[model samples]
Target: MDKAKVLETRRLLAFIAVFEEGSFTAAAARMGMAQPALSIAISKLEAQLGTPLLIREPRGVKATAAGLLLSQRAYEIIGLIESTVEEVATVEQHPTGEVAIGLPSSTAAVLAIPLVERLAKTYPGIRLRLVESFSGYLWDWLLNGHIDIAVVFNQASRPEIISTPFAWEKMHLIGKALPGEANAPIEAGQLTGLPMVMPSRKQSFRDTIEHHIQKQGGTLDVQIEIDAGHQLIKLICSGRFYSILSPGSVAHEISTGQLQARPLAQPLERAICLAQRRLRHQATAVRCVTDELLSEARALIVAGVWDARIEAPLCT
Candidate 1:
């Protein structure tokens, strides 16, 4: 870009913000800039271009035909600038800055610790923010830009969103084992007789488990509904009820004999995915965290720590 174009970049950015926000005052607030400064920049841009770019009104503002054209091109210009800055920052693409990851509470129980440990060792400069919530909330956060990456049981389809099939978190039937009855596989039909404490209908896992049970000519007789993952496990551990969950969720209890889990004879599994917005300028930190998640998941599968099939490699 020439010096004149470089000097006019700030005006284009202001105009872009104003055009998107539909009001000069709102755009100034978003940019943390003075309203008069943005107005001056937009005015200068219009003067140089010799066209009225915005139509100001009492309600707000609307983009003129010229303004709409500039807005479309400005997005491309800004995207390229951001990509260039990141490329010049690190030749080897060392990840820096913050990366946000959203996980379902149950999935986090098993995956979060190891993933965090690996990231801490591999990228000392990169920061990680972990958000645990239901899949629905996580999806909303991912779409709204509150989180950069998410591990969800269900994949989402949209123009702005993308998902990678990372692995499958195997769902197991959980109960307090009868004395001397080792953890072993159980026939799917037996699940219909067990009194169950389950995730609410809104939880995707519940849908997955129920669908599997129905396929087996049985139904989940959920006597109680618990929205929280840990509490659901605790309720099952109390010996009064049963619940189906990933073995990874109660790994410690299963290992130490406080609880027992059995895989269904007819297997049921939850698909685990890494989701992110399809950004024009992908961040190095996001890729670093994503790579670490896959690496840790693979190691866990190899070491028998997590009972999941490696469906896809990093970012696959």
Candidate 2:
């Protein structure tokens, strides 16, 4: 096969419609085209590839093995084209380009909405792409240029990355309140025997919690090491286990009495840092988002809702 040969977008779309609908007649109807025209398009595409892409059955059409491979590539190519067109059309007077940001799941719960709202109002032309994951993956994404910015935890300075201290967040022991239990702070030592569900070890937040637990001369009886944030919260809320998490992550549940959070008597705080690849060009759109992110985080801290202390101000 000639790798350099161009695959016409229209023909690819026609083939995809048939592949999904599984019948030329239905696909042509869905595409608002005649069945014969749709069949000709698919035939031309298969001829170009020099292989049979579809096998006609008594009931409908089924794709050959080669057809399956082309369908996957076709979707990707089409999606990229559509997104590129939309991005180009959005350019105007203000800074305009896609700015990809990475965030931990805990932080995303509190910050994603406000950040999107602020950018839409202040920099309407800027297209924001948010990626939610743990800090370790965020760091890797930043270095790999998969993301332009990331809100990470306790990151040290590296040659390829620049990190600025943004805030420090307090960790709390989250679980359902025991019968008639008071709302006082819980001792770190008490966690030694509790059934717990925690994030896996590679994550920075998990590492921070384990470090403090070991420091307090206690060990966590971890029942499950799950990375999915929502499910972990669910298990804790069901009164089956407890997990140490930042307040922002479980704020709604705590307010509704679905879960109760106790502050650690010996406080454990994690440094929240904003990081970027030092070598990546600081485009106007990216810089605008960076400033807005710092501003929004500062506001959250000052509002007294996020249970955090500002370590670096936006002006810095």
Candidate 3:
């Protein structure tokens, strides 16, 4: 048999319908065709294949052995075709199927929580996945297609990725001061001799802090180097060490007295940027997530909930 002649789509459909409905009359009604026409179509289909396709009884019909074999193959083919149609339609409508985002751990905790919640509520079907890593790792993942977008520091060197400033946060010192020192405003040099829990120097914020310290002719007395914001907060609250972070990460802690946030006399600010691979088209889901993150960031800035001075930067 010619493979092309044997694989008639309409014949396979007709055959399956009859097999499923158990009679030509029933199949015809389901298919919106007359019983005689449906029977004729089935007869012609079986004759073309040179096989007895059905066993007729008084009340209904059953597939002959050849009919049973063809039925299985027909189902597989029909399923694939239907799946292909759905996939094509989905691609046409959304263009991007799903989006994965890489975010800094601190940013995910302080900024991404509400954005993700809003996304779940508003666009439930748009598949969104997040991987929380440090800035360096997140940057690598974004460029490698492990993630579609990244929320990261503006200072990261990624000429290959398109970076846009989405938000800005001022860095601040967080600590549990000794008696009477909590309310006293301390100079940048005052932090020199204190035991400090600081982020790894590889972090952009660490560089900013170090720059400010040197400008003030002071040095950071590093007792611990922890990268995660919550861990830094916990260490500070335990009165074991003092750490520096963007005010956004510790605002709630300061407000609740779990920690105290003080402005550094020397201003240190970091821009937060949304990045995607350069020249790569973004999906609807990625765009939606980025928009929501910016919205939440603005709200936090306005409400002073994050305890930071927020600035919007102009991108050239």
Candidate 4:
């Protein structure tokens, strides 16, 4: 057989395993092969490809620069192969499969807890993988086929993804109730020059807030720009700095007296949107799970689980 033809799928898979597990011995155990046999196979693969794929280190083996590049391509190849197998198997079996959900860290903090629990109970066969990232990264991942779906705030310029409104929530200015400060609504301009902790400029919420401030003839003096919702809430509670967030995120803290939430004057609100790739194929189970999410979200809205002002935008 030709040398290239001798490079079997099994060898490629073994190479990938070693690249991931970082050791020939561990890869052998993972692949159910003797350590020496796995090492021989790796050697054969490197010889066939005419390149060293891994770098031996004292702690563990690391992929070489070439190896790292190959590993990325290997991942995509493996994913496509697995997806094909799963599609064929689904035709014979039921629509049970995995769904990878990408969410912003803030959305995951507020919504994923209950959503995951419900999904686990209702669809035990459907494996759900949640990736928490910022809106930009999540959007990129969604387009790149790294995730199956996402729940995020709608962006002004829509990407080439199919999106549906999942829920709506009012944005609130949360801060420690300062000594003797009136418990009344405060104007957005009043927050100007305050040492507020805000989300990074890339986040949709921060962009909207900044636009609103500028439109009202004021500028925000952001002392901190954090991406993690829990961290922001903790900072607010610790009296270090104040931040703005959707009411849904800070509801628990507000109810428990850990933090105080006030509606911004001339309030802003945004819709939570569910997004999936426009051209990618979605497994039936994933679609069903999304449907369940929408149903539960609607039920939460009806039961007043979300705050009252979150129903629609205060502006329109």
Q: Find the candidate with the highest TM-score and give its number.
A: 1
**What tens digits encode model 2's per-residue C-alpha lDDT throughout 65-85?**
898888767766765665455
Candidate with maximal lDDT: 2
Q: How many backbone clashes does candidate 2 have?
A: 0
Model 1: per-residue lDDT, tens digit, 1-316?
4545633668877887787578888899988999999999988888878889999999899988887777766756765666567768876857678888988877787788988888899998888899987777788787666888888876855434677777886678788863224656777677777899987877766787788789888887889997777788888889999888888878888888888887787876677878875553255667678778888888987898887888643352
* TM-score of every candidate relative to the true structure: 0.71, 0.67, 0.65, 0.66
Which residues of candidate 4, in runs, are more than 4 Å off?
1-94, 156-159, 178-183, 308-316
Give the better candidate number (1 or 4) by TM-score.
Answer: 1
Off by over 4 Å in 2: 1-92, 178-181, 311-316
The runs of at least 3 residues in candidate 3 whose Cα sits more than 4 Å from the true structure, single-residue gaps closed, are: 1-88, 91-96, 156-159, 178-185, 279-281, 313-316
Model 3 lDDT, residue 86, Cα: 51
User: In angstroms, how far off is 35's CA in candidate 1?
Assistant: 15
Q: Residue 231 in model 1: shift from native, Å? A: 1.8
Poorly placed runs, candidate 1 (over 4 Å) = 1-81, 90-94, 178-181, 312-316
Query: What is residue 162's positional error in candidate 3, in angstroms?
Result: 1.0
Worst 10 residues of 1 by lDDT: 177-186
Query: What is candidate 3's local distance difference test score?
Result: 0.72
What's the CA error at residue 153 for candidate 4, in Å?
Answer: 1.0
Model 2 / residue 157 / CA error / Å: 2.0
TM-score of candidate 3 relative to the true fold: 0.65
List pairs with backbone clashes in candidate 4: none
